[model samples]
Target: MKNLERFLSEHQQLTRRHFMRLGAAGAAALGLWPLTADAAPAAPELSKAIETLEPYFTPREKFRDVSRGKPLPHSLPDEKKRAVGLTRETWKLEVISDPDNPATLRSPLTQKDGTALDFDGLMKLAEKHAVRFPKVMTCLNIGCPLGMGIWEGVPLREVIWLTQPRENLRRVFYHGYHNDDPQQMFRSSLPISRVLEDPFDLPPVILCYKLNGQWLDSERGGPVRVVVPEAYGFKSIKWLTQVVLTNLYHANDTYAEGNNDIDSWLKTFAATISVPREVKPGEPMPVTGYAQVGLAGLSKVQVWIQSNAVERPTGDPHFTTAPWTDAEILAPPKHWGALPDGKIPANTLGFDDATGQPRTWPMRLAKVHWAALLPGLPAGEYTLRCRTIDEKGNAQPMPRPFQKSGNAAIESVDLTVKS
Candidate 1:
């Protein structure tokens, strides 16, 4: 897979002229239960005891649900869905200007003369412009991710640019079904530039409808959802219903109320997956976890372990001078195990359609699952910590500490070796 990724990279570079393309957080204040080591949710499927390489694609249903809605759109009763006009048969998408303060581009894309987009219409559009790629969906404040998936969707620009949006459209903000209540609307925005252009070559903002090549089954934001690969989870509003091209230049995120740094980019972080509490003096202790590559990018994952009985380095809380060992980042998995036939769908973005392999290892804005085996420790508990070194060579939490932005704390665990 690593070789394949390298081949894909070199391939893209060599063919750059021919092909161009493409492509927070918060919790409590807005009613989100952030997942962390201590608060790990009961996702039996996601709990990997494997201490080696973690699975590449998470099962759609197995992905943790940290939904923000009161009665999550997918969890809504059939009658409730109908009452809110979210039933697949009757759901309609209104790509319009804010009615109260209409922008120059009003009702740019619509079915018939001016009808909202229906499910079938969205499907029809997908046939022409859908793309697929792996993305790690994580929370802003949490130290862990909800899960990863091969998200499939149509580029937002493809849908918005069809009619050639007119003037005064500074931003494009969207929202999903929220019980027709303004307070409950899980809304987010993007500078029109972020949507229409890939200035930094970041992943294209997509109107996602499928995961792991499977149609979302309600609970996973079926029918439609927004997938913003760069930003945090809040930006990917699910059960999408409306997309507004607004002249409003400022972001209109729902988490803005009490959340700090509503516009901060997601910071890179690492979370340990498995660390056995006890091991013998001559035994190899397996350690594993995943590192989230952020806008800063990722260089490598490192681990530090020291006997609990020994005096710690008092001045180095950040472990700047600690003995850290590099961990091996696992290549992409052999069998995705996500798709029905255990084969990636044809033409997954960032992948070589011919071999169905990703073009690179540790893709930016994705997770790099890592593993390491610790040498025999004589006795006593050991303070074990792991973190990621970003592309800039700065250690975890160095470049970006936990602020109003997000948590990038150095994660640690106490591992006891039986005497």
Candidate 2:
């Protein structure tokens, strides 16, 4: 196997034009057509195209474990038992919107008339118009935890359309049931444009009922939850129960009051590497990890390895000190899953059909796997670092602004290259 450093050095000289031509040919070789670089498709055409490709989308096999550690707000002992006992027929989803006051954002899932829909109702709509897509959910608190899953559900636009918001409505506020505890309540808001429009080629916000072909478990915020493809997990609002259309912008998220950016998009292409903590010299080491971005799907990932002595002598320790030369761009998985001999699975929804690049949606969610081979090094401690380039050409923040917070920082692993 070629060492990662050598692999990177070889491709580093390719210009953008050369890279694109190669990428197009590579995709074609895999039986996938490059997206047509023409005028944007109309909404109806876009919807039809997405619907046509829905059945061919492929999901990753390994589901990362990211369970919320605390007892969920509504998860009392009896409530837990009740949740487990509830069937699709017994479950209900409420949709609420206060067009009059817009200030009284009470209730979990409310509507203009204060009516509720049973699970069957939700399923009926989803069965007819549901879309299947992959989305990466990362906590806003930075390195808290993250997970990627295939979500199936009705578009929030369609669901909200059923309520027929008043003409003046400008925003939508939503939250999940918290055992009727005000103190435990968590909520977030979205611009009405986001709810109703498909700007930036973003996947529609979904009221997801199923994940990876299975009904969601409570631990994963199931029964039903909102899946915001562009934002952090906080905006996804698990245990989702209420959606209130208002004319004013409101940030009610419990964490938003402090340092969290409630409306921020998941813009960083950060990664987590899986490597041995220690390795012997001359030993062949395989480096692997996953990379993700908010809306701008990943375009490239680069990995570098350097000794500790090559320091910048200033700036962030985790970042500025590394010698990034000879870094190699990691390749994506050759086969996502079992596709026909010459066919490719739809792996992302953020791809712009017109430009063959990821859209610049602030919260567009997508992820990809990356792997490389690392050559044995001389006896010394070394750092392995990885960074990602998004479709929009945004490079990972060097010495990331929030390394301590773990948000979008270059991922580094320390290892002893022993003799």
Assess every candidate by TM-score.
Answer: 0.83, 0.71
Q: What is the C-alpha RMSD of each candidate to the true structure, in Å?
A: 12.5, 9.6
- Give a tens-digit lDDT track for model 1, residues 1-419: 45533433443233222111100011111122232334423212112333234456777767888776776777788887876656668777778776655678634655446677777877788898877777888777677777888888888887786555678788888988886778788788888888887767676888887888777767877678888878888888888888988887688887786575666776777878788887776455656688887888888887777555556568887888766766655555556666868787887766788877678766777787765555555556678888888888999888768555877899889977675
Best by lDDT: 1
User: Which ten contiguous residues of candidate 1 have the minimum total lDDT?
Assistant: 18-27
Candidate 2 off by > 4 Å? 1-70, 73-87, 103-114, 313-322, 325-364, 398-406
Q: Least lDDT summed over 10 consecutive residues: which range in candidate 2?
A: 45-54
How far out, in Å, is residue 234 in model 1? 0.4
- Total backbone clashes of model 1? 2
Write model 2 residue lDDT over 99-196, tens digit each, in one string: 56463333335344545766777888976788766676777656523555567778887777776555657787787767666766777778888888
